[model samples]
Target: MTPQFGHFRAESGAGPLRAPMARWMIALVVLLFFSAPALARTAPDSFAELAERLLPSVVNISTTQTAEGQSGIEVPVVPPGSPFEDFFKEFFERNQPRQRQRRATSLGSGFVIDARGYVITNNHVIQDADEISVILQDESRIEAKVIGRDPKTDIAVLKVEPSDKLKPVRFGDSDVARVGDWVVAIGNPFGFGGSVTAGIISARGRDINAGPYDDFLQTDAAINRGNSGGPIFNLQGEVIGIATAIFSPSGGSIGIGFAIPANSARPVIEQLIKHGAVRRGWLGVRIQSVTDEIADTLGLKGVSGALVASVIDNGPAKKADIRAGDVILEFDGKPIDQMRKLPRIVAETEVGKAVDVKVWRGNKPVTVKVTVAALEETEEVAAATTRAPNETPKASIPGVGLAVAALNDRLRSDYGLDEDAKGLVVTGIDAGGPAAEQGIKPGDLIVEVSQEPVTTPDQMAAKVTAARESGKKSILLLIEGDAGLRFVALRLAAN
Candidate 1:
């Protein structure tokens, strides 16, 4: 960084001794004033003390994966009646390919969360391992067993029966950690046990799509392969985050590392220790972001909150009368300023506890009481993919740039829509129109226009006309496609 300085001068002529002293004091004051901000970002003198204290608590995790595989000793293919055929057959008899159980070992890093022998590491570390071992700083290895693990957050808690009390580090308040704060990471990178690296917190609340609960803390710390599940400590030596992933193309640390915030991982860890699984609060609603265009169509002051696409059948959201198109503004007393924040907030809510959910409906805020339910861990059937239809539609909707038609039995079969589906089916979309720009495809079903049901193309056109005549720049549309329901806002200016 470029150095910044301020100029200051002493008052003209006083006592000879006082004049020089005044200038020195004035310069000192100005320099400090100009340097305070940079001083706040200054790096620590050394991380040696912190690393030395933390190394004992951080451990190296070794996992052995035993898998059945055929040996690679290929038998030679000799031509019939060849001169060396007999020799080749005898040589290949003893060296025939055979099935073998191969044992593969991998190394990862974790920390001692409890002295009674509870270790914290990434789930992927010992996912299918036959044997797990934890190595401390003094090179002592102890056989460990998995207590519980949460694959969603990539966190796992292991149990190791140690003869002596283990050194453990407490979790720090990750919410109090600000971006640009200094952080230290101690882990076993590339099998180098107890390696320490230092960097600043680059960002927070990063959603890398790793899982539904993806509130990760990003740092520039040099975390590499064996660094997964390692502890990222603040200057006070408290674990503020757990290193889980890195953004690199070369399979090495490119200075972009992601860690699970201590505050976010704490509840999951505690639940795993108590119950073998995590019982997360579920609102049972499929949601999407309220984009700028959607905000304009809904007459919202600003773009915020998660837009409800579809409430699960007979789920908590449906029981609470939270319909599709409702924007979840606040949950349980916490304001949801962004769409992604709602999921994490809702999941952290206590299951079966009734909470007030403030939603945006009919151009106004409406609060509803909802009892959060435990999320059921089940696999959902994959929806079929959609493509443009070769056949033409019954009618074309004007002003909205959609060639929509009244849904028929034949169109329903072509689009692979539900047998009991309602509303208009999009047979064609204008290539250069507003609908195409907003990702309105040919096989999608238009369920609602401006929060009102539209059964036919003419009704959709009428809704578009009403929105345009009402001086609205855009019209809101709820579309149901293979990917599920989503709200789209198309501009009406081209009409």
Candidate 2:
């Protein structure tokens, strides 16, 4: 028989006056939860000592320009024929300035990259300035001169003669920086002198549509309008990236900031310092993504590379025996992971270096050694081959949207078919038919069906008839349009 108990369970002979274990359990649970985060917090380091060691390197950039100011100008119209108007008119007549404008001022941030007082900042920060000054952390301001500026990349270099040797910061390798690495940003945000914010690298190789070379290092560190051209430091306090832009609708810190990766900007900086401009190597080839259908058509095992749609004639690729149908698997020993990477690598490579290119052509792998050349505008190539003349239409199927015809030159030229094109033209598209729904319009060249090439009307009819006989609902047609080739999945209706 069970004994009746109220709101409690106990073993036989258990003690009734027991200390509560729930409070201890709750305390232990709370301790366990707070331990990890509390241990992860960084100890606060005094910036006064740190700034004393590094402040000599940091510089406050002030720029002034003679722009037409709306304020502090005497009114041009007479104020109720007051005597002051006559005084203003006489003053203006005496000073009759060639350029009627007042001076404007802007502030920004920069750092000395060289002991000789060579500093770096964004081009937009100091653009159109009549006067520029570099204020050191010691409250000593030196007049600066613009050495060079690159508007495309928004980088500028300035020179200031310091009375003493300036501490210079070296750029770190940004390519080795991974996500989750510790980073810090130092700049004059909102004109506040030498502010510092710390965070981890949020992402890498970010493209914010800023420039052609948009390999930005995304970070969560606070970056504002005046933060442009400031140094983004790694854990070693080396400059790894330049804080350039942020993506915040409110123009405040939403934790999304973009910095130009040192891997991309370092070379350009060197070029700018040496020659005052950047000269990127170009290949002059148009490329497209390697889709699944394209990979299958090319007999590639995986879709992991770029597809050469059309090689520019007399360009680097064409001069190096790179053909139209070649699928580039690797360039310069680096795997072509995506189509966008090709342009960046090609632009960074030396123009005269010999590059080894691996390509897939006709179900076989081939290696081509190509000497890179300078890019230029391409010229059109004349027709080298012609299509066979088309015979008249033999039959018009009742349900299908197509009128069949033999491959012909007249139809080929009219369709602007490719040199190797040999496809039966789709003469008509049935209204509300499967072909029409799949965007297979009239005069489209039907190149292949079910991965088999079709040239004549009888061949196309046989393929369709076989597909229907095989109990297939969808017929895949490789249609060639004015742009290029693409696959269309069409659902077959009941015959």
lDDT by candidate, in order shown: 0.89, 0.75
**Model 1: residues with Cα > 4 Å off, grouped in runs:** 1-42, 73-98, 385-393
Off by over 4 Å in 2: 1-52, 66-104, 128-130, 375-495
Candidate 1, lDDT over the whole model? 0.89
The number of residue pairs in model 2 that clash at the backbone is: 2
Candidate 2 global CA lDDT score:
0.75
- Against the true structure, what is each candidate's TM-score? 0.87, 0.67
lDDT of 1 at 482: 76
Please give the distance, in angstroms, between residue 174's alpha carbon in candidate 1 and its true position after superposition: 0.5
Worst 10 residues of 2 by lDDT: 3-12
The CA lDDT at 458 in model 1 is 79
Among these predictions, the greatest lDDT belongs to: 1
